[model samples]
Structures are given as C-alpha cells and as structure tokens.
Target chain A: AQTVTQSQPEMSVQEAETVTLSCTYDTSESDYYLFWYKQPPSRQMILVIRQEAYKQQNATENRFSVNFQKAAKSFSLKISDSQLGDAAMYFCAYTPGGSQGNLIFGKGTKLSVKP
Target chain B: NAGVTQTPKFRILKIGQSMTLQCTQDMNHNYMYWYRQDPGMGLKLIYYSVGAGITDKGEVPNGYNVSRSTTEDFPLRLELAAPSQTSVYFCASSYRGSNTGELFFGEGSRLTVL
Candidate 1:
C-alpha cells in the first residue's frame, strides 16, 4: 500500500511571493505518478500539476511546479507569484502504474495567500 | 458535457438511516471512483469500478457500498449511517489505458449524519 504524507498542516505566503508545500510518500512500486490537487472553499477539486516518477525533470505549469525527488520519495509543490486565489487546501496524491489503481492522498496543507 | 455529476449536493440523515449518492459520467470513462473528504483529511477512496458490473473496495470501504450497472452510472450507498460517516463525497472518472490519465471530478455531495 502506498501512503502520502503532507507534514505541513498550514502554510501562508504574502501576495506575489512564493510558497512550497512539502509532501512525502511510501511506495515500493518503481513506476508511479504524483499529483497536486487544489480544493478551494467552493469545494471543487482542481488539478494543479502532475509528475511522472520516471521523469527526472520536474513538472511545471504556469505558477505551479513540483520538486520531485524520487530517491527521497519526496514530491513538493511550489507556487510562485502567489495570489489570493491560491488560498486553498493542497493535496499530494500517488497512483501506481496499472489499471484500476486508486489514488492515495495526503492529509493536505492549507495554503493562505495574504494580501 | 456533464463530465461527472453527483446528486443531492447536501443531505442530512438520522442515525441508522440509509441513502444513495448518485453519480453519473457521460464521458464513457471506464474507471469511476468514490472518495470522501473530511476536515484536514484529503480524499479517501471508498470504492471504485473499472467498468460496469465490476466494483472493488478501496482504502476506506467500510460502511459503504457501490454498484456500477452501466458505464455511465456508478452509485454509492450507505446503510445504517453513522456520525462518523458525515463527510463530503466526490465522484471522479478517467479514461481507459493510462493509469495516470487525469481525473474529472464532480462538484461533490455533502452528507451530514445526525
């Protein structure tokens, strides 16, 4: 079984600054995928970014990027130029390569972007 | 396109009561999943189905049941609801082939067990 952990319960960043949310996971599977999801107060879960375990280069999307360290089993999310809209709950998820595999998620990190 | 749809955005049930959380996806996705979100807790998989008539348990399957009679509909049922079962439930689906395919989720259904 794979388990994802987000040690940071809460994180805050001033507007236009940068913030990084930490995440770690335990999995024996060599082939897997890591993802970052954001949930606003509206209660809608949105995909922030994703990283393939096999890919050595980190994945970046707009202001969201991931620092994926496969050897350390760590995948952290970084948000640059943070805005008020970035305030939300960020979740780290893992999915092993295969069919019918379910996503294992971390507790989540509440991000507050202060103006 | 009604990627994924869940009914009863909010509901309140008494202890021991039973109700179904309806979920439907029109994208013809082969994989559908049910997840519950609690305060401070991320989504926990309750059940999932690879296709019609094939459902399986997930991380937290206790006190939950699911059935996939058609490719478009996968419904979750809670029998004898308990206070601990109060949480927001989400339904998601993804295309076939790659396990890493992006998932499309429904708004969610908030259930409160009194």
Candidate 2:
C-alpha cells in the first residue's frame, strides 16, 4: 500500500508570480510514478505533469515543472507565471512501476490565483 | 470527440433505493475506472476494469458494484443507497500502456442520497 500526502489545504498566489505545491509519498517500491492533477471549478480533472522515479531529471511542461527528490520522497509542482486559470484543486498521485494499478491520491490542495 | 461520457449528471436517491450510473468511452481505451469524490476529500477508487469482462475492486468498493461486459461500457451500481454514499462520481478511461498513463475523465455524476 502507498500513501500520498499534501500538507497544504489551500494556497494563494498572485498573477505572474510562481508557486510551489508540496507533495510527499510513502512507497517501498524503487520504481514508481508521480502525477499532479488539476480540478477547476468546472470539476474536470486535468493532468498537470508526471515524473518517473528512475529519472533523476525532473519532468517539465511549458511553465509547469516538478522538483522530484526521490531519496526524500518528495515531488513538488512549480507553476511559473501563475494565472487565474490556474486556480483549482490540485491533487498529488502515486502509481507503482509496470502495473496498471489505481492511482493513490492525497487529500488535495486548493490553489487560488490572485488577480 | 466524446472521450468519456457519464449519464445522470445529477440524481437524488432515497434511502434503500438502487440505481446504476452509466459510463461509456469512445477512445477504445482498455482501462476504465469509477471513483467517488466527497465534499473535501480526494477521489476514492470504487472499481476498475482492465478490459471487457475483467473488473477489480479498488480502495473503496463497499456498497458499490460494477460490470464490464464490453470494453466500451462500464456501469456502477449502488445498492441500497445511503446518505454516506452521497457524492460526485467520476468515470475515467485511459489507453493501456499510455505514454504517461493520463486518464480522460467524464463530466461527472453528482448523486445525493437523502
């Protein structure tokens, strides 16, 4: 069994600024995957980014990046130039390697982008 | 494209009532899943199916049933609904061995048990 933890229940960031949402997971598997998902007011779950534990180089998507610290079991999402559109409930998830298993998610952190 | 579709966008069920939440996908995805999201909690997996005729229980499967007779359709059944079961349900699908295993979700079905 694995568990994902998102300590921040809510976060506020000003437009054009940067914000980092922290996430931690307890996994005994050496190889796994980490993901960040966004659910806006519309309630649509959107994938933000993914990181593979084996890869030391963090994964990035445009202005979205992850600081994956494998040893410390931390994977935080960094959104550069935050916009109002980024306001949403963000979830951190974990899945094991080579398995089509269900994702284990944290409680979630609601992000608020200040105009 | 209708990636994932769920029926009964909103429903109010009385105690002990039963209903099935319909879900279907046109993307030909091999993996389908059912999840429930509470007021302030992360989505909890109810059930998952790998392909036609192959279904498995997930984190929280009590009080819910599901069937995958075909690859495209996966329906979740709530037997004897209770207030504890009131929540928003989501249907999601993804291609087997997806590059990043990203799930495409449906609009969601909000069920209220009173």
Candidate 3:
C-alpha cells in the first residue's frame, strides 16, 4: 500500500508572495506518478500539476510547479505570486504505475493567502 | 463539457435512512471513482469502476455500495446512513491508462447524516 503525507495542516502566504506545500509518499514501486490538486471554495477538485516519476525534470503550470525528488520520495508544490484566489485545500496524491486509476491522497494543507 | 455531474448537491438524512447519490460523466472516461472528504481530511476513495458492469471497493467502502450499469453513470448507495458517513462526496472520472491522466471532478455532493 502507498501512503502520502502532508505534514502541514495549514499554511498562509501574503499576497504576491510565494508558498511551498510539502508532500512525501512511501511506495515500493519504481514507477509511479505524483499529483497536486486544489479544491477551492466551490468544492471543485482541480488538477494543479502532475509529475511522472521517471522524469527528472519537475512539472510546472502557470503559477504552480512541483519539486519532485524521486529518490527522496518527496513531491512538493510551489505557488508563485500567490493571490487570494489561491487560497484553498491542496492535496498531494500518488498513483502507482500499471495500477488502476485509484489515487492515494495526503491529509491536505489548507492554504490561506492574505492580502 | 459537463465533465462530471453529481446530483442532490446537498442532503440531510437521519439514521438508517437510505439514499442514492447520482453521478454521470460526459467525458467518455472509462474509469470513474467515488470519494468522501471530511473536514480537514483528504479525500478517501470509497469505490471505483473501470468500465460498465465492473466495480470494486476502495479504502473506505464499509457503508457504501456502487453500481456502474452504463459507461457514463456510476451511482453510490448508502443503505443505512450513519453519523460517521457525514461528509462531502465527490465524483471523478479519468481516462484509463498508466499515463496517470488527471481526474475531472464534479462540484460535489454534501451529505449530512444526523
């Protein structure tokens, strides 16, 4: 079984600043995928970014990026120039390669962006 | 695209009350999943279906049942609602493969079991 851990229960960032949400997972499989999802006040789960375990390079979206360290089993999400809209519940998820599309998610970190 | 839709956006049920939450997707995704999110907790998978006529239990499937009778519909049934079952339920769908395709989620259904 794979378990994902998000040590931070809540985080706050000033407007226009940056925030990093930490995530770690335990998986015996060599191949897998990591993902960060954001759930805003509307309660819609949106995909923030995704990183393939085999890729050495990190994944970056508009303002969201991931620091994926396969060897350390760490995948952290970085939000640059955070805005008030970035405030939400962020979750880190893991899915083993070849397994069904079932995701294992961390407890989650509630992000609060202060203006 | 109406990616994934869940009906009964909010519901309040008493103990032993039974209800069904409807979920439908239009993305033509082969994999559909049901998850529950409690306050301050991450989403936990309750059930999943690979395709029509095939379903499986997930981490927290004790009090819930699911049926995938068609490619686009996956309904979750709560036979006997309990206080422990109070949570926000989300329905998601994704393409089937190892690419780890992203999941498209519905707005969510908030259920309160009193």
Candidate 4:
C-alpha cells in the first residue's frame, strides 16, 4: 500500500513571500506520479502542479512548483510570490502508473497568506 | 462545460437511513471515482469504475455501494447511515490515458448523519 505524508499541518506566508510545503511518500512502484491540490474556502479542489517520478526535472506551473526527489521519496510544493488567494488547504497525492487512476492523499497542510 | 456535477450539495439523514449521491460528468472520461474527505484529513477513495458496467472497491468502501451504468454517471449509495459516515463526498473523473492524469472533481456533497 502507498501512503502520503504532509508533515506540516499549517503554514503561513506573507503576500509577496514564498512558502514550501513538505510531502513524503512510501511506495514500492518505480513508476508513479505526484500532485498538489488546493482547496479554497469555497470547497473547490484545484490542481496546483504535478511531477512524474521518471523525470529528473521538477514540475513548475506559474507560481506553483514541486521539488520532486525520487530517491528520498520526497515531493514538496513551493509557492512563489504568494497571494492572499492562495489561502487554503493543500493536499499532496500519489498514484502509481497503469492503475485505475486511484489517488492516495496526505492529511493536508492548511496554508494561510497574510496581506 | 460542466466537467463534473454532484447533486444534493448538502443532505442530512437519520441513523439507518439510506440515500444515494448522484454524480455526472460531461468530459466523456472512462474512469470515475468516489472519495470522502473527513474534517482535517485528506480524501479517501471509496469506490471507482473503469467504464460502464464495471466497478471496484478502493481504500474505503464499507457502508457504501456504487454503480456505473454509463460513462457519464456514477452513483454512490449509503445503505445505513451512521454518525461516523458523516463527511464531504467528492466525485471525480479522468481519461484513462490522460497526459496529466489529473482528476476533474465535482463541487462535493456534504452528508451529515444525526
């Protein structure tokens, strides 16, 4: 069984600053995928970024990026130039290749942005 | 387009009651999933379907049932409601060979068992 862990239960960042949320996973499969999802107060889950284990280069989408370290099974999400709209509960998820698209999610990190 | 839609955004049921949560998608995705999000916890997979007439269990499927009659709809049924079953349920779908493997989610259905 694969499990995802988000160590930080809560994180805070200033409006113009940056913040990093830590995530780690345990899986035996060599081929897998990682994702970061954001849930605002409106309760809508939005995709932030994703990373493929085979890719050495990390994934970046606008202000959201991931530091994917396959060897250590660590995948962290970095938010650059944070905005107030970024306040929400962020979840880290994992899915192995060739599966039925089932995702394993971590407890989540509640990120709050200060203006 | 309405990617995914879940009906009865909010519902409250008495103990031992039964209800079904309706989910529909417009993306023509072959795979659909049901997940429950407990307070302060991540979403847990309840059930999934690969395509029409095919369904499977996920991490947590107890007290729940699901059916996939068409590629566009997947409905979750709670046979007997319990307080422990109170949570926000989410319906999601995605293409089998999607490039990003991203799951498009519905707004969610909150159910409370009292």
Candidate 5:
C-alpha cells in the first residue's frame, strides 16, 4: 500500500509569478509512477505531468514542471508565469508499476491566482 | 469524442435509498474505474475493472458495488445510503498495455446522502 501527502491545503500566487506545490509519498516498491493532476472549479481532473521512477530526470510540461527527488521521496510541482486559469485544486498521485493502475492521491492543494 | 460520461450530474438520496451512478466511455478503453472525492480528500478508488465481467474492489469499496457488463460501461451502485457516502463520484478509463498510462476522467457526479 502507498500514500501521497500534500502538505499545503491552500496556496496563492500573483499573475505571471511562480508557485510551487509540495508533495511527498511513502512507497516501498522500487518501480512506480508519480503524477500531478489539476482540478479546476469545473471539477475535471486534468493530468499535468508524470514521472517514471526509473528515470532520474524530472518531468516538464510547458509552464508546469516537477522536481522529483527519488531517494527523498519528494515530487513537487512548479507552475511558472501563473495565470488565473491555473487556480485550481492540484493533486499528487502514486501507483506501483505492475498493479492495475489504481492511483493513490494526496488530499490536494487549492491554488488561487491573483491578477 | 465522448471520452468518459457519468450521470446524473447531481443527486440527493435519503437513508436506505438505492441508486446506481451510470458511467460510459466511447474510447473503447479496456480499463474503467470508479473513484470518490471528499472535501479535502483527493480521489479514492472504489472499484475498477480490467475488462468486461472482471472487476475488483479498490481502496474504498465497503458501501459501493460495481459491474462491468460491457467494455463501454461500468456503473457504481450505492446501497443503504449513508451520510458518510456523500461525495463526488468520478468515472475514469485508460487503455490497455502500460500500467503507467494516463487516465481519462469524467466531469464527475455529485451525490449527497441525507
């Protein structure tokens, strides 16, 4: 069994600024996958980025990127040049490599962007 | 493309009431899953199916039941509704092959048990 933790329950950032959301997980498995999903007011869960445990390099998707520290078991998301649309609930998820793809998610962090 | 569709968008139930939350996907995905989201809790898997006629319990399945009759549909049922069961339900699907593949989620169905 694995669990993800999002320490921050809420966050805010100014328009065109940068903000980072922290995430940590507990897993004994060697091979796994980590993901970040964003849920806006519309309640649609959108995948922001993903990182494979085998890869040492972090993942980046445009304005969204991740700082994955494998040994420390930390995967943080950084949103740059933040926009109002970026204000939403961001979740961190974890899943083992060989399972049925059941994702264990963190409580989530509500991000607010001020213009 | 009607990726994953779940309905009704919102529902209110009383104790002892029974209802099924419908889910359907047109992407021909082989894997479908049911997840419930509480206020501050992210999503907890209730049930998932690898393929038609094959389903398994997930993290939170005590008060929920699911059936995967067709590859396109996986419906979740709540029996003897309890206030503890009130939450937003989301239906998701993914393709076969990679276990690390991405999941496509529906807009979600909000249910309130009184």
Candidate 6:
C-alpha cells in the first residue's frame, strides 16, 4: 500500500512571497505519478501540478512547481509570489502506473496568506 | 464545462436513515470514484468504478454501496446512516489514459448524520 505524508499541518505565507509545502510518500512502484490538489473555502478541489516519477526534471505550472526527488520519495510544492487566493488546503496524492486512476492522498496542509 | 456534478449539496439525516448521493459527469470519463473527507483528515476512497457495470471497493467501503449504471453516472448509497458517516463527500472522474492521473472533482456534497 502506498501512503502520502504532509508533515506540515498548517503554513502561513505573506502576500507576494514564496512558500514551500513538504510532502513525502512510501511506495515501491518504480512508475508512479504525484499530484498536488488545492481546496479553497468554497470546497472545490482543483489541480495544482503533477509530476511523473520517470521524469527527472521538476514540473512547473505558472506560480506552482514541484520539487520531486524520486530517490528520497519526496515531492514538495512551491508557490511563488503567493497571493491571497492561494490560501487553501493543499493535498499531495499518488497513483501508480496502470492502477486505473486510484489515488492515495496525504492528510493536507492548510495555507494562509497574509496581506 | 460542468466536469462533475454531485446532487444534494447539503443534507442532514437521522440515524439509520437511508439516502443516496447522486454523481454525474459530463466528460464521459472511464473511471469514477467516491471519497469522504472528514475534518482535519484528507479524503478517503469509498468506492470506484472502471466503467459501466463494473464496481470495486476502495480504502473505506463499509456502510456504503455504489453502482455505475452508465459511463457518466456513479451514485453512492448509504443503507443506514451513522454519526461516523458525517462528512463531505466528493465525486470525481478521470480518463483512463490520462498520463498525469488528473481527476476532475465535483463540488462536494456535505452530509450530516445526527
């Protein structure tokens, strides 16, 4: 069984600053996918970014990027120039290749942005 | 586009009451999943379906049931509600061939069992 862990239960970032949310997972599968999902107070889950284990290069999407260290089983999310809208609960998830889309998720990290 | 839609955005039920959570997707995805999110806890998979007429259990399937009658709809049923079942339920769908494993989630349905 694969499990994701988000050590930080809560995080705070100042507006226009950067914050990094840490995540780690335990999985034996060589081919897998890692994802970060954001849930706002509105309760809508939105995709933030994703990383493929086979790819050594990190994935970047606008202000959201991931520092994926496959050997360490660590996948951390970085938010650059954070805005108030970035305040939300972020979750790290995992899904092995050919698993048919079943995902294992971490507890979550609640982020708050100060103006 | 309305990616995924879950009905009865909010509902409260008495103990032992029976109800169903309706989920529908417009993306015609091949895989659909039901998950429950408790306070301070991440979502836990309740059930999943690969396609029409094929269902499977997930991490936490007890006290719940599901059916995939069509590629676009997957409904979850609670035969007897309990206080432990009080949580926000989410319905999600994804294309089987999506390499990134992205899932489109519906606006969750919040349920309370009193």
TM-score of chain B in each prediction: 0.96, 0.96, 0.96, 0.96, 0.96, 0.96
Say which docking band candidate 5 falls in: medium
lDDT of 5 at A20: 99
Worst 10 residues of 3 chain B by lDDT: B94-103
What are the candidates' individual DockQ scores?
Answer: 0.62, 0.56, 0.64, 0.58, 0.65, 0.60
Q: Estimated TM-score per prediction?
A: 0.95, 0.97, 0.96, 0.97, 0.97, 0.97
Tens-digit per-residue lDDT, A1-115, candidate 4: 7899999999999999999999999999998888999999888788889888899999999999989989899999999999999999999998888778568899999999999
Q: Give chain A TM for each model in order.
A: 0.97, 0.98, 0.97, 0.98, 0.98, 0.98
CA-lDDT, candidates in order? 0.91, 0.92, 0.92, 0.92, 0.93, 0.93
Ranking by DockQ: 5, 3, 1, 6, 4, 2
Query: What i-RMS does every model get?
Result: 1.9, 2.0, 1.8, 2.1, 1.8, 1.8
lDDT tens string, model 5, B1-114?
A: 789999999999999899999999999999999999998899999999999999999889998899999999999999889999999999999996225548999999999999
| Model 6 chain B weakest lDDT span, ten residues long | B94-103
Interface quality of candidate 1 as DockQ? 0.62
The true-versus-predicted C-alpha distance at residue B40 of model 5, in Å, is 1.0
For residues A8-111, write the lDDT of model 6, one tens digit per residue: 99999999999999999999999999999999998988989989899999999999999999999999999999999999999999988977746888999999
Candidate 1 stretches with Cα past 4 Å from truth are none
- Give Cα distance to truth, residue B45, candidate 1, Å: 0.7
**Angstrom error at residue A91, model 4:** 0.4
Error of 2 at B31 (Å): 0.4
* Error at B9, model 6, angstroms: 0.7
* Model 4: how far residue A57 lies from native, Å: 0.5
What local lDDT score does residue A73 receive in model 2, on the 0 to 100 scale?
98
Better of 2 and 5 by lDDT: 5
* Tens digit of per-residue lDDT, candidate 3, span B28-101: 98999999999888899899988999999888999999999899999999999999999999999988642475
Query: Of 3 and 5, which scores higher on TM-score?
Result: 5
In candidate 4, position A20 carries an lDDT of 98
Residue ranges of candidate 2 with Cα displaced over 4 Å:
B97-99
